[model samples]
Target: GAGVSQSPSNKVTEKGKDVELRCDPISGHTALYWYRQSLGQGLEFLIYFQGNSAPDKSGLPSDRFSAERTGGSVSTLTIQRTQQEDSAVYLCASSRDSNQPQHFGDGTRLSIL
Candidate 1:
């Protein structure tokens, strides 16, 4: 029940709907990252947070995708107006620093209809 945990291991949503996925990172970890892996694709970084470092959302596919970290520990990723192209395994990881090897949790499989 430690390390990292993600909610709604599986989510089914209709296209154009909004959904939120939560991530609980390891205690005391200062770096958190959001990534998504589509079928046969490498992990794609969406955003990252480390201490007060500004988050990098350059990898976010669209404005519909956003994330926020709270207390520098828990984070939530929200996808608005989800589309079929957004369907993928959303993964969350955290590390001691941005350059550290992030520990990942079983991702939330989002299916958009």
Candidate 2:
């Protein structure tokens, strides 16, 4: 497909476990973004990467959350010591540039027990 794709569309894990979610962006897209959706929390931008370089990571809430990109195409979001509060829908979006509109993937639904 020529759009963003995310793996493990749904995940169920116990509290304190670590989880890794992956996202593959459309071909030739240089900008990728990660966002989280929680009940009452709304859509929150987590991080962004441009051409394998992340210029703004301030959106990441804590050290337990981190992300990285490889070959400027794929990105992975890792959460350490997952908590029930971490349960949310993690979304991935891609754009040609910051000024361009982004296309999103079906978010990965994370459930922490």
Candidate 3:
């Protein structure tokens, strides 16, 4: 079973551009989480989705950040009008439950110039 996976391990883009990062969680997992990690920093919770719907969207930093999970499995984080401030490693994780340990994917590192 795939624990979790992300794409474009590294991405570089100009400011005001848009980017999409993908995540694939482990099978049968019902909880998905999105987090951001700046250089030399800890993971910052972004949004949380249960099944295929986002229930806790409190962590989205700004309107520029949005995400969606479909079929209760695959998820995508889309950044609109990307900015230098948006540069960070986007991480996705999933767990059997909120209290359970989440398995994290490598992450998608995005750089804005």
Please list the residue runs of candidate 2 whose C-alpha ends up more than 4 Å from where it truly belongs after superposition. Answer: none
What TM-score goes with each of the models? Answer: 0.93, 0.97, 0.94
* The best candidate in terms of TM-score: 2
- Model 1 poorest ten-residue lDDT run: 50-59
Cand. 2 TM to true fold: 0.97
User: After aligning candidate 2 to the native by TM-score, how far in Å is the CA of 69 from where it should be?
Assistant: 0.2
> Judged by lDDT against the true structure, how good is candidate 1?
0.89
The TM-score-based order of candidates, best leading, equals 2, 3, 1
lDDT of 1 by residue, 49-100 (tens): 8864546878889989888887878899999999999999999998988778
**lDDT (CA) per prediction:** 0.89, 0.95, 0.92
Error of 2 at 27 (Å): 0.5
State the displacement of the C-alpha of residue 37, model 2, in Å, after optimal TM-score superposition: 0.8
Clashing pairs in 1: none
Q: 2 or 3, which is superior by lDDT?
A: 2
CA lDDT, candidate 2, residue 6:
98
Per-residue CA lDDT of model 3 for 1-113, tens digit only, reads 66799998999999999999999999988999999999766779999999988989999989988999999999999999998988899999999878899999999999999
Winner of 2 and 3 under TM-score: 2
